[model samples]
Target: MSDRITIKFNAAQFLTSAPTLKHCPPDTGAEVAFAGRSNAGKSSAINTLTQQKKLARTSKTPGRTQLINFFTLGEEQTRLVDLPGYGFAKVPLEQKLEWQKHLAKYLEERKSLKGLVLVSDIRHPLQEFDRMMIQWAEDSQMPLHILLTKADKLKKGPAKNTMLDVKRALKDFQGEASVQTFSALKKEGLDQLKSRLTEWLTPDEADQAIEELIDQDSE
Candidate 1:
């Protein structure tokens, strides 16, 4: 985390009012999400990102995270939501649709959602479902930062190539985007993510920093 940034942590189980497009944890602050396929290391990535081992529960079995779990940063100044993983699971199609519905409601209606921290296995980066989630974030006009998980399982060259491929995938999507290789097992890339997260959590300061950058460019 940035030395200059103040951080707060809280959590809640917010429900999405079905067919009505309402989501819980209704506080106006920047929200980011960690999304991916079940068993794609989403919970592990989240736990690593927050520096909290159990912040997001991890299960070897798929379909464990059925509801939206919210983790607050900066005391609601920002939220890091753990959205249930989608695709390649044993859940029934109708239930999957509801999950999609629930997620859609939050993405479209949650004014606080500022960014999405998409997690994907490096072995199969930008899988079909991953692309769809990225599309949702783009359509919602939220920034996206992809976490290429399981980096330690690959050779360094392959890992670099995977990162390159993931970046290319985002080119088809619009809005601000970035990619960072991560290994929850090794806890690599935590500091980079923390710094970027701090900026995302603090929009006013981020905006000021951007303005200063623009001024410097002009000068």
Candidate 2:
């Protein structure tokens, strides 16, 4: 296998926000999406990953991220998607359903989606909505990386155990799955998360060489 490319997450910039899959940018590039329940630190993780203080807005009120937001790396074809937060009880049932419908359509139909990052609070991991996401990824044969956010809130021992427990719980998923502890405040597990995203979004050396050759020929 060819060597993998390194991605500069810090350079990520807002691309666009789409209310539904139809509004999304043309589906022709590799993108990994982040999903989690409202106030579960999903936005924090995104900001931390990109080393940007405000790449994704962190709201005190839950369910504020009603749209699917997209961020592009140096290349438009490499992207990181911030999906709408789920399981916000304050939202009306109809609105919640609408968000879920759009989310499902994007996950099920987006050809450029390469993987998923499911963020959950380390203190309360694997809630109902999180399990639903895991099942969806398994059914779709999509690779998933679970981020146990807020690791700084717990003692080291408990945090480690939580990571292990989450891994054991997902042993039956049958698709590519991994778990790690993270703390946006502490900047913990940032490298691991970056590595996973890079693996998903970066094209290998062979593909890069071919693209370069094609560009040269076109010129």
Candidate 3:
């Protein structure tokens, strides 16, 4: 375990939303995308992570968010993308296919995409589309983090079992990824989640400082 210093992430503010990759903001910096099945609490997780009540739009209806939403974290270059949810969209199949195509284009070709943050309901994890998303990350050799969202719905033991099961299933994955249980409502695993993100998003200077701290402790 790294006894690293706490690295604070700046409050994320809404940057923009685009229906297509071409309409997105310039791709010049690191970005981590949040993806999940429809109505899987992706928006709620984003809101909770940013400590804002309404940073990302939340709706009871599935597939309410039709566009790709971007939020900048302190810096203009570092971003968190809230991608349109897959599966169970009430829209026509033709429209759903369009969303899927756009999503695939962004995931496959975006130059600045650094990682993926996959959100899934703990009760129904690793669905077909979820598996596809994981495969995309693996194909790109990018790091992926799976958030088993709505963990509060399950009992503690069952949640742990689910997380373990997911992790075990990921052993066959070809690239780097991790799985964890999370609950935006109960604020469970928030610190650990943020710490994992900090490991990915920490700037060079902050990383150097952490290294120095580690060196001093060793001395």
Best by TM-score: 2
Best by lDDT: 2
Give lDDT tens digits, candidate 1, residues 13-37: 2323223235466756677777898
Error of 2 at 91 (Å): 1.6
Which of candidates 1 and 2 is the stronger one according to TM-score? 2
User: Looking at candidate 1, what is the lDDT of residue 157?
Assistant: 99
Instruction: lDDT winner between 1 and 3, please give it.
Output: 3
TM-score of each: 0.83, 0.92, 0.87
RMSD of each: 6.3, 2.8, 6.1
lDDT of 2 by residue, 86-203 (tens): 6775878988888888888888999899999999999999999999899888877889999999999999999999999999999899989999999999998998888888888877
After superposing candidate 3 on the true structure, give the runs of residues whose Cα lies further than 4 Å from its correct spot.
Answer: 1-10, 203-219
The residue pairs found clashing in candidate 1 are: 8-74, 8-75
Estimate, for each residue in 1-219, the C-alpha lDDT of model 3 and write its tens digit: 365434334478889999999999998766788999887889889888888988888887788888999988887778889999957877888998898889988998887787789999999999998998998888878789999999989999999999999999999898888999999999898988887776666546765687689889999
Question: How many clashing pairs in candidate 2?
Answer: 0
